[model samples]
Target: MNSEFTIAIHSLALLAYRPDHMATSDMIAHNVCTHPARVRKVMAMLRKNGYVAAKEGTGGGFILKCDPEQVTLAEMYRLTSMGSVKPGWCSGDAEQDCMIACNMATVMDQLYAGAEKQMIDYFGQWTIRDVLEQVRREQEKKPGV
Candidate 1:
């Protein structure tokens, strides 16, 4: 739901794609098509969560610490966008006397929460490794990736 989730997934997948499963933020940012600072922010969260380990100084970067097959998209969703599936604004004006306007926001909130749960459940079915495989398949379809 948020860019952070996608960036985290892409950064992790890039690490997994490499032979040693390690890379600097610059490399990840280039591969993910995002700015290096954005990559660093997401990488910091990933590192704090034990999914990655960072090293300091020259020739140092990040190393994938978790098994891709054991990490699900649902986990990333929870970490970055668990309650973000719902919109912050609703179409209703609670000050109005109309019953629908007074209750629309509440109803939409419930609906969005339920939908988020279902989406998270669906995301649970796909692991990081599955995502990597998807990337590989996409690359295979290209003439020269």
Candidate 2:
């Protein structure tokens, strides 16, 4: 659970709660208890992925670009990660593979690929709406006014 993933998901969930409203980075940072710059960077990535829309000038902020039900967690995770992970034990380099010649490498490769696939598949099964609903349920469970 990297901060990026948590922040991205939290941002998306917040946007989903108010799809038509543009939330400023400062507001989002306040909710996440992080710096505004970090929120802005995450917003940039979300905007680049077509997951969010930003407006400039007065009342400028970010809004959800698509329906929460249409946006899978996997897509959000992929956008946040920027496709950094590869589909093997090591990156695409012949020399590295040659140097680590052993069955362990092959086994590790399968394990890593499987883990990545599982993550994608799990997130793919849920949408931002699901996350928000879970939050709501947890809030309901709390004993407070």
Candidate 3:
């Protein structure tokens, strides 16, 4: 899968972790270890989808709009990375004379689609709050945390 999905989920989870549930793009980028522009790009998508809201000017940033428990990873995936698990280049050419080479692309496409659906369905069972809680649980097991 593309990094956008992870970025989106991480961004949301980070927001949920905050007591205020609000953070600037720079803050999120630091937490997620990415560029602010990337965070802004993904946050814009989330904002457009009504998962989060943006506030301008000083001391303003993104505010969580949806209930964390109600926002599933599946929704994030669909919003940021649906149909993205598949590779763009499959090892086949339809014009090739060999049967395997000619059809491998189509077969891989269908297989990837099925796999993505299964993954999304599995993600549907977990919400943003779950992710935040899981991270907290994982951190509790570590000394540095």
Candidate 3 local lDDT, 24-57, one digit each (tens):
9999999889999999999999999998889898
| Local distance difference test values of all predictions, in order | 0.91, 0.82, 0.90
lDDT of 3 at 19: 41
Models, CA RMSD each: 1.7, 3.5, 1.7
Off by over 4 Å in 3: 19-21
Model 3 C-alpha RMSD to native: 1.7
lDDT of 3 at 129: 95
- What TM-score fits each model? 0.91, 0.82, 0.90
Q: Which candidate number maximizes lDDT?
A: 1
Clashes of each: 0, 0, 0
Displacement of residue 1 (Cα, Å) in model 3 is: 1.2
Against the true structure, candidate 1 reaches a TM-score of 0.91
